[model samples]
Target chain A: MKKIAKMVCILVVSLVPTLGHGAFQAIGIIKSVEGEVYLISSSTEIQAVSNMKLISGDNIITGNDGSVGLIFKDDTVVSLGPNSQIEVQDFVFNPAEEKLSFAARLVRGTFSFITGQIAKLAPKKVKLTTPDATLGVRGTKFVVEVK
Target chain B: MNRSLRVLSFLILSSIVTVLTYSGCSKTTVVLLKDPEGKVGHLVVENEAGSVDITKENEATTIAGATSKPAAPKRYSEDKISSQFGEALNMLPTQPKHFILYFKSGSTELTDSSKAQIPDILKTIELRSSEDISVVGHTDTAGNSAYNMRLSQRRASVVRKLLIGEGVRADHIQSTSHGEANPLVKTADNVNEPKNRRVEVVVR
Candidate 1:
């Protein structure tokens, strides 16, 4: 059954330019980790670790007994419990310019989210998508479980 | 091949039975979200049942399950937000750490005790291999709303710089100002409250 989880294998060919002068490249950071976890970006799968950087469009997967926590540019905290996979579908934040956006897809497993500065600055811009539903946030703290 | 088709069948069947009649084989994906930052926002939840708007901070909304069109949204209190997702939260690591730092009246300066609290914060951060820190500023009701707004911004900026100076990654930290709107203690207009003149920090 796990074989059905086809990997998109994204090859971030678009070079990430320098910051401040352009769009902010990195959107999140791995704040914590336990057990088995991996980050599938482009066509690569990298083992997860504390402090690992996360960018938009990366698919994160965790094995049994594995959990990972992440923090975005807006201080939004999202932690994934064991045997789960989630994707950072979209993220955009530029306070000086008043531009903000956040969207994610929790494919399976459990993950808790605490709204970040992006939601507080722009609530309408925050959203979380699931297999059967789409969630809009108002600077909140809540968890999602997909069975 | 059979396994993948079975999974696909499950998805198709779930959608087909998503109407008024629900089947026992369907998978229910539950979603809960609460806004504890006290930011008043109109959040939209769209699904098979219809759509509902979410407003007010500390308030929460939940969708019972989704292998089909999800059930109608349900709202809950702040404390109930986590408990409502108890099954999911139980699988997570220890709860995130929260810290409250007090400020002087009408000033961005940290109080004596709060200043002392910085060391513990720094130590805790050092212990973690990875970190995302949030520093939010707030003010009491002693000044005009506009004035307090700017004051809160100044306070958050002051603390953000402090953390950055202490070696926290600048990009990983988020700083915000809530003015007098989100007070720890409710107070009448023009009333001063020490607890309200503070900063809230969360380390995840």
Candidate 2:
């Protein structure tokens, strides 16, 4: 039993250093996944589970019955409805240094967003871009379905 | 303040005149939000329809006809449009914000690479409105439990000092040490794992 735990810990350690080496950090974790949710990073797709760390450049997709919720470092909450696709373009939350930003591209489907500390502190820095238009936040919450 | 009120009343009076004169077509819908303290945000309506500006909180204007100007601003309530904004949280990623500063064997000082990650951690603190922080220190299993506990406490203290020096409110931070009890790498007793001897800082 001890050997198994040790090996598992070793494997996890070896796998972490190879991920997300740039300034793009893991901005949030998967709080819950209802149905089919996949995280596509680089070129490989991995099944997403609760507590899975997500980073920039990762594309999140949900199946017809799928939905995902995430609680970000800035205490911002996000829920992606089914049949949705989203790409995290960039995310930066450095409260001590006062550098906070959030930008994402929602290709299609439905999503509900609650503005985070970044938006509360600096509303102009947050942008949500879709194919037809770009959405900015003045209010704290918005839900949109892109046709 | 009086001048602004006068301008607003004048605009309302003129809009009333325009609506009465041009009340020949579609009905005008005025969506008003109730914010006596006026703490709402502005919304710029620029879809396929003509552009309209809702500058003040909880107020909106809709013209009666296609080419007519918008009617006077009206107040809207929070419950009226609550459903319009979905409740699904759209959160940014949070994983990268968690930072771990590794230590050399038998030393509480940060390793070279860990030293480099400090600036980013400080920057993270600067971005938040308030600090909600946790610092947990650990040591490799190379030493006895008692000694490791003290060592880990020292390490946590070092980080706490740095954070306080860099502007993190001292009271907002909680620090603890788990010497050789929990290991990131799960090394055997008397083994030295750089990853195991570390301090983890979580900021929420």
Candidate 3:
């Protein structure tokens, strides 16, 4: 019986990460889209639509007339302008465990960002990287353009 | 004659500075703006060369390259900014909304006044196409910590069921419990606080 109980404990511990939270959960949602926006994940590209859940590691690409808006679980808002590409590199918002992080990369084009709970709770953990420089956000609204 | 020369030189220098600031825009540029609440936060633009801090609204910095430092922040006109980033700025998502519902002590039942808010809550969830809702439960310090945790979980589930019955998708709702760890009103162990026994629903 003791051996069986130990095995059960190990199974539960291993399953914790894959539960309906953490890395398996949706990090944000596409709130608005215009023109020709596409979401690329796992080498698959799909036309972007409002209310679509987005996970980390997903790439958002826009055409010449495309624009998109997204809202993360922690209320962070990100918008991309025409002819833009951005990657959601990392995002973790687990307030209960005090594990908070937000990171993204803008390869080109224009971006608008508004800080959320993650930045307010742990400002240093938030980062927005561009080709030339990286922005360390401190709970603010900002815009970036990369030529 | 010297005074006039100084004024003329100042004008020339100012114009030159303006030209440099605006002309070097081929690289990455970051501009700080105020939030919807009219609050401006600071940002740090850093690279291998150095870092530039932006504090004021409409302040901007340009980074020429990875090896070069960020430029000193300069105030940009509203017209210039709108012309560059108007599309992105206009696409910002609406802010999330939060609602709190009080619960009866030691049970999954909601208070009378809180029950009356169900209609409004349902309306909020209905308005958003792919709305995501989080129902977090909390309890006052009126019981054992272990028991309180279980109680809060039940409370959260209760709210979750109510939303689902009202047409909210079960997959869109995430239910969790914080027990008495996060109390609206702090108190000693085993103290009963009505405000602390509540569930918070965030609609995004």
Question: Best by lDDT, which number?
Answer: 3
Ranking by TM-score: 3, 1, 2
Please compute the TM-score of chain B alone for each predicted structure, in the order given.
0.57, 0.55, 0.78
Q: State the lDDT at B97 in candidate 1.
A: 61
Error of 1 at B73 (Å): 5.2
Chain B fold agreement for model 1, TM-score: 0.57
Collision count of model 3: 0
Residues A46-143, candidate 3, lDDT per residue (tens digit)? Answer: 99998888898999999999999999877789999999999999998765455678989998999998888778767898988987889999967999
Error of 3 at B47 (Å): 1.1
- State the weakest 10-residue window (summed lDDT) of model 1 chain B: B19-28
- For model 3, how does the per-residue alpha-carbon lDDT over B1-204 read when each residue is reduced to its tens digit? 699999999999998876566435447999999998999999999988899999999999999866678999999999989999999999987777778899987889999999999898888877866467888888999989999999988998999999999889899887878788777665789999998898888887
Candidate 3 ranges with C-alpha deviation above 4 Å? A1-19, B1-26
As for DockQ, the candidate ahead, 1 or 3, is 3
TM-score leader: 3
DockQ of each: 0.20, 0.07, 0.32
Tens-digit lDDT string for candidate 1 (B126-184): 77533567778889999899999999899988988998898888886767777886676
TM-score of chain A of 3: 0.85
Per-residue lDDT, model 2, residue A135, is: 51
List residue ranges in candidate 1 displaced over 4 A.
Answer: A1-24, B1-28, B31-44, B52-69, B73-121, B127-204
> What is the C-alpha local distance difference test score of each model?
0.68, 0.65, 0.84
lDDT of 1 by residue, A5-81 (tens): 11100000001111333333777677667889999987699998887777878999999878787766566777887
